[model samples]
Target: MYEHSSTHPADPTTPADHPAAPDGNALTRQSPFRRTVLRRVLPAVAAAGIGVAGFAGFAHGSEGGRAAAATALSRDTAPGSALTARAASVRQAAAADFPTWGTRWVVHASADVNSPAVGLINKSAAGQDRITADYQVDTGHQVCEGSACSTFMAHLTGPVTGFLTVVAVDIPQDRLPGVPVHGGGQPQPGGSRQEMLDRAATWLTADNGSQVPYSQAKVWKDGYRQDCSGYASMALGLPTPGTNTVGLATDRSITRPVSLGELKPGDLLIDAAGDNNNRHVVIFEKWNNDAHSSYTAYEQRGGHGTDHRTLTYGLPGGDAEFKPYRPVKFGD
Candidate 1:
């Protein structure tokens, strides 16, 4: 069902994925000075589980204060609790299951046992800790601290839980998966047309063709976002974590606009306006017919994972925002 004819079927209506909103109420009333002071002191107080009365005085009007109090209380009641134990276990498991693409750590955090972890940040060689990629931890859902939830695709083995575990591993430069490497392990600016299509095909049936799940908030194990732009980046052999649709469309170094008639295999059709949820991109495969009214394309959509289907985007009476662009790497 991955391939389709020129009479393209109606695309499935998928909900837009959006990042989580900040909890504005958490620090709304605290002055800068008070907030700074609280940040330095709350961790120690929470760990020691002391000064409940004193901390309660500060909790009067701030959600952050109340949340801190609750944390302290939880720690006090169960020093070295099951969640803590599970964190240690998950950390080891993540390390043992480290991916070959690069060396990074998964720092896991959770709200409670009933809910899945809210944060899973990866620390990369640049000394920056971020949620650059996502994998399914278990049958349950996994979410970043301030991002939306995505479905579980790959499963994590061992004693896994709804708690956070941080695992760190080192990846050598030469082994960056999926992207072509040259000049002592540096990823090439772009890939060949066949290379792009081959890379795109992997996700269609990931893990020997099982299909990587669709996720705006998570990255596939290959270290690319599991969204349209990210998938396209993998095919193009761009750097890890990929660029946004706007970046792909507007970045002259990456791609240049082309007329609809100029599109070739491995080129792109990107809708580069609006926010992440509104914008979309697809990799051009080939025209479905000699008439040039429809073409087959590969895309990692919200509801569906990787798909190769016929589309009329940018053709007459089709979606106008989706303009064609050729990857600079092709040099065609």
Candidate 2:
């Protein structure tokens, strides 16, 4: 449900098909449920072969010490020193997958989309003693159609056992509600990223026809939603032509498809929801490479007039991260 505050105006960017709260945790696998089938039980049976593993000691002993006079360095040695250390700690926590690895199950949104882990959790293992990694479905943004559009493909390595398959869940177009398409013409305020994102979020909330109501914004001549994408579209003066069974892109200005490798800050990000086809949309803000993988973003959560927060996810939400999907190029 959407929350309200007087400080923010009505937003227009919320996608029409924004998803509801996710059903459950992503650890448990949907298939492989049958007790009698042979191939269905293969994975659970094979996992029994792993032995009880135990972690050993760390070698912190100084091998060859040459005593010398020492001067301790101060914490102020660098600007933002403390802040950097805190950031490092946050990253370290996100990276560790030990406690919840084996007990978790993989919950696929559809045959196409797989879950991106929201957080790590622990569960007792029935098949093997080893901890299994927990994974969950992604529920922010709009893509091709709806259902399964947000499906995922994950990469797994040793000590972090998870998924390593390549199939996409397909959200069909029919179930999705269309975006109320409108194009703001030239001469209005343009190029403000946050403003645009706010609008998109508002519009999306409105589309769901849910119980909550969103905030409103007043441009020169129109009453806008205070969500993210709505603001982007309003700034660009793109028309609210009508909703598509699939979600709408930020700019009608886009002609050529953009490759994921070339995404820019202001470009629009789309997502597919299970059963609904193209359920939501959000904008890309920035990218950081120092992390293990790329993250896509969205501005609000819980639908309707909700407070704004930054939400990041696996690169492009699917296998598209591996190849390329014609992304809308900036200044194009």
Quality of model 2 by C-alpha lDDT: 0.27
- Candidate 1 lDDT trough over 10 residues, lowest sum: 72-81
Model 1 accuracy (lDDT, Cα): 0.45
Whole-model Cα lDDT of every candidate shown, in order: 0.45, 0.27
lDDT of 2 at 60: 13
- Please give, for residues 1-332, the per-residue lDDT of candidate 2 as tens digits: 11112221122233332332221012222233211111111122122212111100001111122111111110000001011121223323222122222222332111111112221111233332223222221212222111122222222222333321111111122111121111211112233444334333333333233212322232111222333333433323343212321334433433134656566555554443223322334456556565525544433332343333343332544323122222232344
Model 2 alpha-carbon miss at residue 91, Å? 39
Please give each candidate's TM-score: 0.47, 0.30
Per-residue alpha-carbon lDDT of candidate 1 for residues 264-294, written as tens digits (9 for 90 to 100): 9999987765555457778999999999988
> Candidate 2: misplaced stretches above 4 Å?
1-16, 20-232, 240-256, 272-278, 292-296, 304-330
